[model samples]
Target chain A: MSEMREATFLILTALADEVRHGYGIVQEVSALSEGRVALLPGTLYAALDRLAAQGLVERDREEVVEGRLRRYYRLAEHGRTALAAESARLRQLSTAADARLRTLRPRSV
Target chain B: MRRLLFFYPRAYRRDRGPEILETLQEYAGTSRTRLAVNLIRHGLRTRLGRPASRTVVVWAALFTVACGLFAAAFGSWVGWQTIRPLHESEAAQVAAELLPTQNLKVDTDEPPAKFVIYGQPLGWYSVRDLLLGDGGEYGQSGVGAGSNGPADHPERDLATLRENLRRGGWEFREYVRPDYGHEVYAGRGDQQLDITFYEYNYGASYISLGMDRPAPALATVGGVLGFLAGAVGGFLLFGWASRRTRSVFVKLLLGFGLFFWWAPIVLAFPQMVEHHLSEWHYSWHPLWEWLGQPALSLPFLLGTGLLVLALAISALARAQVRRADDPVPG
Candidate 1:
């Protein structure tokens, strides 16, 4: 079974909100991951190519800003589903860790 | 950034170059060096038509040739090892002609002839190449070693040896050979026998005999041809396959290639001193030497293997997705 890479997950998460160009998603992903993940242009674009190929995210529109044609991408139905599934999975994992830490935490102190 | 973009396949760049460039400019915190390296790796070669049609060529060729070359080298090493045992058996065969009661003689049956002296086997030493000719034909080597024989009395045994040779259907050179104490020569078909008796010291005599049959070099030639064929075929396949799959595996493979492609640039003295900001006190030579080890090459093999595995995974994932059609199971 093919597991989604963290970068792929982040890319999908970035597109889940609205249509965003390549740079927009890169910045958004960094902010969303809280600087824990910085998407290099190559990595971000490569992930975009893969996701687009997999029918996850797709080209939304193209706009020329500052003489550079920025292509925007938005999540497809599949992309939304996949992102939801992956985010839910991660949430479950974080919740488990949170529960485990709660037991380990000092009680009533 | 533009230069780095060239590391990608031209076709790929043709399709997405403008958009990617725009993204790069718009995207803050982009590492040009890392992106360049990544592009070089992933953009290795362009894919042909589509990803589905392109076969994994380099990985397959690498696997086959690696196995073939190793096997060939090992077989050659082993064949060279057989020279000693062969000489021993040849010596034994020669020894069998003499009465052990009168003189010490050891005999065994081992083909691929060699010369034995005083029961000590002597043949080619440190023989690097072993043709080991095929078609039931074997390679031959002649060796001559001096040993004290017959109580160091060649004068007493010369007449007796001559008589034995005559009886054994060996024709001797009737004339005294040039620059030799005593020499016996006999030939039958392609095989030649030569024995030289010389004085080793005061009242000490040493004798040497060598029998050899030169074998054809067809096997080595065939081996070389086969190796070349495998390499060439693999290269052609790579050229074809690279045109098909524009996957990350291909990109990384070429990115690794960029490391090699610019190796000379990296190693240039001026570039090392100036660009790399390193003092040129010959530290690079040691690094260069260290990197040249056969073990270092294993990383290349490992990296390629990983890429091939990734290629497989990509193909499988796509296949699974296609099989499922619409909705993919989480």
Candidate 2:
């Protein structure tokens, strides 16, 4: 499979631990990215629909709160596998970059 | 939030509208303009469906361009309706007044119709003839006159005819000499005149005059507007049909329709471009000819029938139901 986009990685990461509603995912993604990635409703829903279509996510349940519909979503088995593979790929890259930076640091000093 | 939800397709809006609205309300402090724009963009995308299929876009684009071209041709035809047809007597009278010698025998033929196939008006009876070898004979109608024999003092006669046309309010452009003949073009208002003189090595020569009208400005303007409208409408309609059905037969019908309709245009466009570049045209050939219209009317009609059938099948098919486990409601 191709490497996951940063936004997709973050979104999948946001859903890794627990099932979340739309706004919950939005808030979590924002916090995960240190307030750098704020997903609007339209963008977030479109991504959710694509993920669900790809079988990476599935509807967990639904509730009514203050006369508004709140639908929750959770990662599926395929999504967990994909997330783990992507995480491993990123960790390897990060470790290699850190080693290179450490070697450059002593020469610069 | 409700107004922004309106941008989504009807089914999608019904399924996920409330959920999306609730989310938008939570982000109430965010820019409404940005939210609205994003909603509109994604809403239109959702209408197309098949999110993972890249070919859907290519098919939609092809359908749109073909539809736009056909609409433009129809608009140009409507514009042509404004022109007044030239009578055979008018052409003969002009020929008689312009001829230098009274002895030259001139014959004038009346135009059968605004457009004709093999000198007759197009009709159901002529469809076979059109589809056969005679298809190339389909052309615009025009009043024409020709001299039976070579003109006496051909060079002097040309000057005399040019002077006579000038006196009769005709504005002459520079004459062109192609492989076949020396041709002079002139215009007065909507009326256009082409005078061609053919000379052979054995001193055999004759003059032919063709009188018609230039394409009206209204046709050009209307054609452009029609193309724009047709393009947008075709794209939306194609998307609607594509998303409404998953049947393989319907997709095949659409493919066949596009092939039949677009093939003639694909063949004729480059040749027409070459013709335009190689010749000095007083008035352009009618719009239909470029589309290979009545000439290729058989295939055009077949394509139309196939598209109608495809759309009918799509209409009869049920819309795809959202899966229970999908996060989006429908």
Candidate 3:
């Protein structure tokens, strides 16, 4: 399986919680990633369009609170499944690395 | 900056022009040393949908050159027509009469249709109508050239003169003003005569005649040449553009070809070949004649239609072949 980039992982993780508008999703992902990535508007929208085309996410609803339109998108079942598989894969890799590092530790002589 | 107005999609510009400008201003403000480079790069990308590649620049240069050549060829064609007299019988004789006495120089070696007199300058329509036979008041009035001020009414004078000539036994069957100017070709059989008047001003006029030859041949050749120039220019532009976008190339070719063929032709360099030319004849009393070199516009019309049809078919075939090679994913 291909490893998901941090940004993609954070996006999928944010949507795993609940449906969110574009701005809300951005804020949620930023908070979850601890400010490591600041996605530009172009990058964010491009990713969203691609993900939506793949049937991983979809527009759930739309509402206008002010002059601007707020579109909400929800994670599809396939997206949740993919996120779970990515998480499990990452956990296995991390565990194996930790074991290797412990064995390489220098003993007190 | 102004041309950037055409860069964006029309609907998008209409909706967000001010907003886009405001955003660009803010973006540019953050950079000082990189301002020019940044804007130029972004502008190219936006207008061309690609970076400023050498290929794109080369294509643009090629398009500009093709357009320039087409304009030059058109100029040459029109210039040749303006100076040469075709064989027009009654009209040629009338044009010859209208010439001032001092300008009546003719060479026996020259064909009857090739005679030209020089003296005073006259407008194109005034000479054309008189030589080709007038369409009466409406035509004269529409061109603002009826027998009033030469600037505003050459048509009227030419019309009245044509009516007189018609009554006086000059015969005109059909004619058209392809470019500005008048011509009449007459005679009984395969042999014909040509008379043309042009560049008239004040009371003076310049006229010429060629006898015993058909003027229709001249008209046909000129018209065909003009049509070819238009189609060839469009084809060159399409070839240059299709490298990047086939649909855009096809659309532009069709649109531009139609525009050149059907639109009212406006002379590009009108002032260069008028009024002050030494060949204008101004000394003679106005003599009118009726004649015609019929079917002038046919070749241009037919040629344009044929070329457009050919290009459209080629484009369709290319599109079909491309689709067959790469079927779309359902």
Candidate 4:
């Protein structure tokens, strides 16, 4: 089946806290990822639209500031579920790799 | 960590860009550079797998191809219209009338009715307008004019004109209007050019070419080619700016500043200088001269500007998305 990419994962991660507009989502994702990522408008919109379509995210509300329309998005129940699944998968992979390395390690003399 | 954000495509950056940034600031103590790199690398590879990017690019390419073919075909059709046999005879007959009575000689070797002008050389202005009567310079005067150049100057050297007429393939004619003055018309058929030396009250000389219809096929094709050229050039420059400066903000500013304000302004330089920014020539109409507005003046300027803006914005948005997910260099 289809799965969301890491960028999209980070997008959901940003929204995991609370609702956010376009810029707000970017800010949150950056904070969560430690400035390791950024999003531009085009890419953001494309993902937002796709996630909303797939029932992963929903438009929570709209606000206007400085004469610009900003649409705020929130994670849907489905989005939370997807994020949980991905987190579990990453955790499992990390644990398995750690275990394998420990068993295969060379002991220091 | 701050710089690693450059790895994501622009779309990824815009949606999650701010949050990711804020998160980085909040979690600065961790040595997460390696994780950031891995995330970016994964982000771009995933973005490339996206069907949307391919959809946009392919649609754009198809549109360009359609436009190019349309222009070439319409231009070719107009060319075909000018070379039909009857119009050729008409052109030859008209050319004969422009010659003095003494120079008109019947050619028995050819068709009995066919006559040739066998005398003195004529001045360029006297018969220049009549040569490309239907497919004249005027029709190609719009955006296509840049591509036309002097190759289609109609008034070929006298030797070529004479040789062309002797082959008996095309005809030339003359048009006389009390207001317009002595004119020569030449065409093979539907395609014709009526060439006339127009003298303004100010003593400036001008040449006017009229066409039955403006070729949409040509213009559509030309517009598409123009769009593709603009898109490719625009994307590369913006992408490079993002890389060199390591600033999305800078890239956005430069993209809009150059594409919308600078490029069109640059393209308009020649026309603006020539016209001196005066009122466009076709702005007013005479009371009785039922003839419609002559083509090519202001519409091209505004149309090109609008077209460029639309393409630039689309490309900018796409680039922003691609850059958002891009990985920063080590």
DockQ of 1: 0.30
Model 3, position B240: C-alpha lDDT score? 36
Every candidate's TM-score, chain A alone: 0.88, 0.95, 0.91, 0.90
Candidate 3 Cα misplacement greater than 4 A, ranges: B1-330
DockQ of each: 0.30, 0.54, 0.04, 0.03
iRMS of candidate 1, Å: 3.2
Residue-level lDDT tens digits of model 2 in B128-195: 88876467787667787888767666677788888888888887765556665678888777878888
lDDT at B281, model 1: 23
lDDT of each: 0.55, 0.81, 0.47, 0.47
Residue B13's lDDT within candidate 4 is 64
Writing each residue's lDDT as its tens digit, candidate 4 over A1-109 gives 2565878899998899899877778777788888887665445656786888889999898655554456688999999999999988889999999999999999999
**lDDT value for candidate 3?**
0.47
Better of 2 and 3 by lDDT: 2
- Model 2 accuracy (lDDT, Cα): 0.81
How are the candidates ranked when ordered by TM-score, highest leading?
2, 1, 4, 3
> Which of candidates 1 and 3 reaches a greater lDDT?
1
What TM-score does candidate 2 reach? 0.70
